[model samples]
Target: MESLLLSHSAFIPSQNKEVGYLGRKLQSSFYGNMVSNNFALRSNINSANRSVMISSVFGIGRKVKKVKKETVIPEPDYRIPIVLLGWSGGLIYADNLAAAVPIGLLGLLLLVQTTRVRFVFDDEALEVKVGEQLEESGENVFVGGKNRWKYSSFVNWELWWPNFPILVYFKETQTRPEGQVHFFPVIFNGKQLYDVMVERCGPSKTSAPKES
Candidate 1:
């Protein structure tokens, strides 16, 4: 009976040792799994933060829109008509009545036209309109027949006597496919006219008229 009791006691200690070892192994495995899950979660959060920072700094995935502004047309200028009247007066002073009569009449006509006519430049075309309200002028008296001309149709343009501009000449295919030439006295501000022409129709082929 004493020998049997000793064997039983030894067996009980071995069983307890096995149970403690198994419990420790299970705890270690559970802790390892938790650490792995935490590491993965932190990595995902850091990746998301980096993506947001990059988008803010570099303007990625953002659309930029452009706003177009309206073009402002210049006011009428009377330099041409004033010069014509002055010339006519000079001729009368010189006692040249024959030349003075025609010259003075032309000056008067131009002065009247200058008061009513205005050159309106839009984004794509140049228009000749009359009065304070800017009503469209009827068909042109000269060739081309129309009062409006698109910048794209202009084949060439010139400002006569650049220093003291007198006439503006431009040829366009808008009226005729073969190209029609039109001439106008520079009744508008020369600088403004030249600037608008260059901007809308591109640079002129010739800046000044050729000497005869």
Candidate 2:
């Protein structure tokens, strides 16, 4: 569950998808609070729009221990969060808002840097842009990487906490199984991305047009 609900959260994307950082921040902020369990998500989309509705958070940034003086991207502020949004699913194509902010002032305090988020859906894989501030502890570093996954490799999924967060785990593969997983959140409106997963996964493969 959310540590505390706040109405005044940062990271709101505009209608044209100009804003960035907020959605990714929200995902990272709520990621740790995730729990492991199985639960079904109800579909809220009607017949008129068969397209799936989801808020994809593409995270960008990596953790650097000691904050070395030399690096890429100049004068980066490890204080503010950055987020960018791109929405897509079936027949639905529109920019969407984010859900509740993670814990409390903690998110504000913890956001040393922000991530970039984008959403991609094709016949091969469901790609959502996701990078991390790269968890750092002055000594070790934890990178926020691997924001893409194949539905075929999808082993199972679980709802994080109270409302929209979801934890999707993948099976052990060539380079995966090193605890490879991604965290995604659903936008408000009584809908869940799990429904999209149920509808999009597996079928997208068979539905692909075959080459002659």
Best by TM-score: 1
Per-candidate clash tally:
0, 16
Native-vs-model 2 lDDT?
A: 0.35
Each model's lDDT = 0.82, 0.35
* TM-score quality measure for candidate 1: 0.65
lDDT of 1 by residue, 1-212 (tens): 88999999999999999999998899988988899989999999999999989998998988977654256466667777777788889999999988888888888888888788888887678888999898989898866377998889999999887767788999999999999988888777777778777778888775544323
Number of clashing residue pairs, candidate 2:
16
Task: List the lowest-lDDT window of 10 residues for candidate 2.
Answer: 82-91
Q: How close is candidate 2 to the true structure, as a TM-score?
A: 0.29
Error of 2 at 153 (Å): 0.9
TM-score of each: 0.65, 0.29
Q: What is the lDDT of candidate 1?
A: 0.82
Error of 2 at 114 (Å): 10
- For candidate 2, lDDT tens digit of each residue in 1-212? 24333322322324224434666666766764352111111232342233322212222233545642221121222222222111112112322222223332323433422233333444555554333442222311233435445656765544333242322333313225554544433221112333445444532222222222
